[model samples]
Target: MLLVPATAATIDRRLTGRSPVDGRPALVLLDLDQVQQPADEVADALARFGAGRFADVRQLAPERPEAPDMDGLSLLSDLMPQVQKALDSGDASQRQALKAEVDAVLASMPEAPAGRDQPRLDGVLKAMSEALAAEDEDAKPS
Candidate 1:
């Protein structure tokens, strides 16, 4: 799952292809320091990616309450060598053990909060423009 900044919310809006006639992503204590990400960019990557171009994408917000899928691909980020060794082991028991360990990581993620409803990106863009205008106003000599 991708964790990105709220500013890129527009990109996510388009990717989900949900109704823009809704609202916005709620302002939560979203933690994105672990990865270099932005909201819109996250959606763009997902929407534009194809098989093998990007690893499988499954998002699980730590703020939510549901158990995420126990998929090894999700844990591949930190256990590539172990995962590879397991896949290459060819021994059923070894492979099952490795896969199970990774699966636990997926199952343990904190759930995301009830998501902010989808909405048109126009308001944010307008707000940005207005903020810029205000900045320019402040910069002018009195």
Candidate 2:
């Protein structure tokens, strides 16, 4: 009936009866570290109780993987503001040049790890594309 973080301190507290839900029955503690997995752990646990109306299940946390190094993408933090400024200026030539520069920077940089920095990179690209698209729309005759 309770979903909690898979940390040593939390497990210790729960095991020592110090948790707020200590006295509650039908407690299921699960730790999922998979990048993709179904959300049926609770349902499976409940099914196992089988008409007992009460059960307690606990799972130890897995070792966490190290975060991917994003040093190569750090320059983006500086470049993004410049890009934004160029977009706001509404100068087609400047925006085009900046886009080329940004594209070159991105191409030279190392690929981001899946499910980590990819989303961030995609987001930046999307923002740039949207700004350029808006600029194009504004240039069109009414």
Candidate 3:
């Protein structure tokens, strides 16, 4: 008769390979303040990092929707579609008018600490504004 004491490392290795598990959740630290890219891109990159190296990776912190900056960003998101629709179908004159409204909304946006969606929203709005302005210029009579 042969006998071997059953242990976690043996069981874990048999089940999943790479045993001697630490039993502590591993963490991946990222310093985003230095990333200088839109938040969505950063988030996408993090999400696409398929789990093999580590046990898990997930959103550790959620954006505070109650934050004032979040509220402004939400408002900008709501307003963006209108701007897009106007650009798509409305005449150049209408686009110019909407552009002023966009500028005002942009100017009124309060300065708040960076959040997940804030940079993304800012980038989209700036790009949209620039596109509308360019279109307006092209529409101008020479």
RMSD, every candidate, angstroms: 28.1, 10.8, 14.7
What is the per-residue lDDT of model 3 for residues 22-128, given as tens digits with 9 covering 90 to 100?
Answer: 33322224455667897677666655773343322234334346644667577777877877887787488777787787787667766657643465556667777
lDDT-best of 2 and 3: 3
lDDT of 1 at 98: 56
On the 0 to 100 scale, the lDDT of residue 141 in model 3 is: 86
Candidate 1 local lDDT, 50-116, one digit each (tens)? 4343322334323353363344234344566655564455555665565555455534644433665
Candidate 3 error regions (>4 Å): 1-74, 112-118
Runs of candidate 2 with Cα error greater than 4 angstroms are: 1-73, 109-119
What's model 3's TM-score?
Answer: 0.44
Report the C-alpha lDDT of model 2 over 33-106, residue by residue, as the tens digit.
44245546554656676445433444433436557447636666777787788888988888778777766655
- The residue pairs that clash in candidate 3, if any, are none
Best candidate (score: lDDT): 3
lDDT of 1: 0.44
| Worst window of 10 by summed lDDT in candidate 2 | 17-26
| Model 2 accuracy (lDDT, Cα) | 0.59
- lDDT at 87 for candidate 1? 49
lDDT at 27 for candidate 3?
Answer: 26
